[model samples]
Target: MIQTEIYNNGPVEVAYQVYDDFYHYKSGVYYHVYGDKPSGHAVKIIGWGTENKVDYWLVANSWSTTFGENGFFKIRRGTNECEIEENVVAGLPKSSGNIIGGFIAFLALIFYYMF
Candidate 1:
């Protein structure tokens, strides 16, 4: 069920995702009803399905992937997720051979959404 890959063997850096731009909202609920992102903020970039020469950068929503091609929404690109355009941060590290630590957290978050 997991399609995304996380590379953290090298230096840490923000995702230069295949898509462009990022979406941001003030605050909201995620999943069916489990993870309450009090942080109320996240950056989502639609995974331009494989095959397309140039992929599209769409915005992800709480809506299930069933809604769209894979539960994603198409929003304009070049949009800023928030004001302070802070430096990007690497995602889902997986180098130290001890990725389990991060994977566990990832699994917990996933279960929270599923349950």
Candidate 2:
């Protein structure tokens, strides 16, 4: 599971389909279920927790602090909401030197397809 990956590693990057509700999201656990048209977007899943019995994944959005919860938001976990669980990418560098290069390559790949 993605949660397992996060526990073993660190943050994971996920590419998912975003709807109108996601753009306007402010606070609380977000669970997307409407039929609004979706566009491709990506975010980093940094952690997870349960709020009021609702399991959620804490994510860092690229949209900046003006966005949801100071650039972080919680989404429903385990259900693959917005197919966020799909297209997940994570890697552990073999050495400290490779970390920056590896991450830059990953971001370049993501931006290549996202734009």
Candidate 3:
């Protein structure tokens, strides 16, 4: 789960318009605008970065990398643009059969020592 501020300007509706639908032309850092409103939209936070000593957050978009900064975009850090800074959640990685088997073996050894 992710959080961001209200898209009063409606990001999904405005991003294309702002970039003019030009692929490979939208490459740059992004910033957040602070205010009271929630658009109920979600975007994945890919990474973090800093330019010229300024902080920012990296966002991943469905549009191909050619569309925007290698399929990613930067937004203002710490401001929670569109409430992005709030209520974030990530899932644990899936375990493979081999890993589970190894864990089970380790547990068995521990049990043997205790008994």
Candidate 4:
């Protein structure tokens, strides 16, 4: 299931974030499909940013809006802008070339546990 795929990335950082893929769609999420299995979607990539305004997430999508900025979703930061249902900040991808991301994540977990 999508949960397993999301969990595989471990507790620190996630490659994708699992969400109910039946309704909500936005930037940063990737859809998963398997033979005869119920598929779910996940938010791919973490620590990545866009040149757009910080209040919104510049997402690239496969929708018909491909001709222009419509191909993307300006997801509200610190908030959810859902077509039907709002999504939460599920997980984030570690930054590319992030040799120390794992270490930071580990330290974060330790710090969380200690607190």
Candidate 5:
């Protein structure tokens, strides 16, 4: 038998001073590691990565593709640069179109199986 354990912890409050500092952005990578001051804004962590032996996290931004890496950017991992790991939000898969349409499709599947 295989055993597994899960840990569920709440979000953490982090500080970010370089919220508008995009000049440091290059090739879709965000390397802002100076902002020690706190900001009221927030971001979400989508994934993680390792480049040149440096761990980092893949973050999504609201600025759209015009921003960095088609609206996505990478930050140094572990240290929680720009507070990317703190106050994080998990995104859900978007529905096809509308709730009614999804419901209708679900019902059709159920009916087809029953009849």
Candidate 6:
């Protein structure tokens, strides 16, 4: 479902459970298999592709470019890896044939999350 949304829409916001190993993440496909007491974290999955026979979701993290793969990382796709597939949210601006309307829609989404 997340993949489908990305294919049709664009980036999708996803809330994930972060474990201890996530802090050490630097490069390559991230697949957390162990650790306990995961904290909540959110990231945007902009796209997906296969790498070295491994399917992954191209995710953009908020930790800045100094973090994983220039602030982006690939995580094992499918199988609900780290429950990332769950709690997916996506929205499309209602096309009112005007730029202001579109911008308002975008702002509304931000406000929805803020409040």
Name the TM-score of candidate 3.
Answer: 0.47
Question: CA lDDT, every prediction?
Answer: 0.34, 0.85, 0.48, 0.37, 0.50, 0.81
User: Model 3 shows how many backbone clashes?
Assistant: 16
lDDT of 3 by residue, 1-115 (tens): 1223222211221121122222333656554323333234345665666877767666767766675677777766666544456534332235533666645654554453344
Prediction 4 global C-alpha lDDT = 0.37
Worst 10 residues of 1 by lDDT: 12-21
TM-score winner, 1 or 3: 3
lDDT for residue 106 in candidate 2, whole number 0-100: 79
lDDT of 1 by residue, 3-85 (tens): 13222232221222222122232222111223333332233443323223422334455555555445554422233223211
- Model 3 — which ten-residue stretch has the worst lDDT? 9-18
Write candidate 2's Cα lDDT for 1-115 as tens digits.
7878889888998887787778779999998856585588878999999999999999999998999999999999988888888778888668656687767867875885568
What is candidate 4's TM-score against the reference? Answer: 0.26
CA shift of 9, model 5, Å: 13
Q: Runs in model 6 with CA error above 4 Å?
A: 95-115
Show model 2 residue runs off by greater than 4 Å.
Answer: 95-115
lDDT of 5 by residue, 1-115 (tens): 0001101322222223355465346554566645443333444555566877877666566667876787766777777565444433222225544566645654554453345
Evaluated against the true structure, the overall lDDT of model 5 is: 0.50
As for candidate 6, its clashing pairs are none
RMSD of 6: 4.7
Candidate 6 global CA lDDT score: 0.81
* Backbone clashes in model 2, listed as residue pairs: none
Please give each candidate's TM-score: 0.28, 0.78, 0.47, 0.26, 0.50, 0.77
